[model samples]
Target: MLTEKQIATETHKQKSKFVTVIHPEKLIATKTTEENNDNTFLISWLFLIGSLMFLLDGFIELSEGLSIHVLLHITASGVFTIASALFIPKK
Candidate 1:
């Protein structure tokens, strides 16, 4: 029963009720290029160190035949060593 003009005006009124939305720009901590590179290098080194530890454990297992104690010792020492190195203060 509504005319075309009436429908158009009603739609316009509903759309105009919403205000324009503005989104804030993302805030990210910017690191220096050297620092960024250092982070990536440190990550790669960690991967390398982890793989080395796994390989070392494999070797220890082979030599020890079938001993869980030696395996546990090696794993614990590797973890502790890495943790200490990471926690140490840098000059």
Candidate 2:
């Protein structure tokens, strides 16, 4: 009868057999607390700003006439803008 702790250890050992990890600590080291909120907030806003700029550039190019290129530019910018929103800090 294995204890819960022993079971978890055994499971981890078995999983490690099929996969090799280098610098496993770094995988989990990035998470902490609210201290990272500021960085996330700034980076998310910057990313959104860049996306907006790209969208603006697409608009400027719009004067050239609507075509596949303009549509693609607007689409890519929209995707990145949505992704950047995921990084916004939660309250």
Candidate 3:
């Protein structure tokens, strides 16, 4: 049966224990915009190459006519495609 005032004081004490006192003006990004964009594109290109390899493997399995290997390759290719798509550049 704590009073509202008692509860608020306790809550304030707990919150203050975790409060960080950093100046907002001191925060900065380490990488330039162009550098970040280039890194993203490079990672996406590597993933795209892997996905392409899986796609080719799937096509080869298709020639064997409907098997688990084909299904697995297709599933892997689709997953890799989605992953790679996330890092692709907008421009």
Most accurate candidate by lDDT: 2
- Per-residue accuracy of model 3 over 1-91 as CA lDDT, tens digit each: 9999999999999888775777766666367889988898888889888887888888888898998878888888878878787768886
Residue 39 displacement in candidate 1 (angstroms): 0.1
- The list of candidate 3 runs beyond 4 A from truth reads 1-29
lDDT (0 to 1) per candidate: 0.69, 0.85, 0.83
Candidates in order, TM-scores: namely 0.38, 0.59, 0.57
Q: Write the per-residue lDDT of candidate 2 for residues 15-61, one digit (tens) a residue.
A: 88775667978977877667688778888899989888998898888
RMSD for each model, in Å, please? 9.6, 8.2, 4.9
Give the TM-score (vs. native) of candidate 2: 0.59
TM-score of 1: 0.38
Off by over 4 Å in 2: 1-32
Ranking by lDDT: 2, 3, 1
User: RMSD to the native, candidate 2?
Assistant: 8.2
Worst 10 residues of 1 by lDDT: 21-30
Please identify model 1 stretches exceeding 4 Å from their true place.
Answer: 1-25, 66-91
RMSD of 3: 4.9
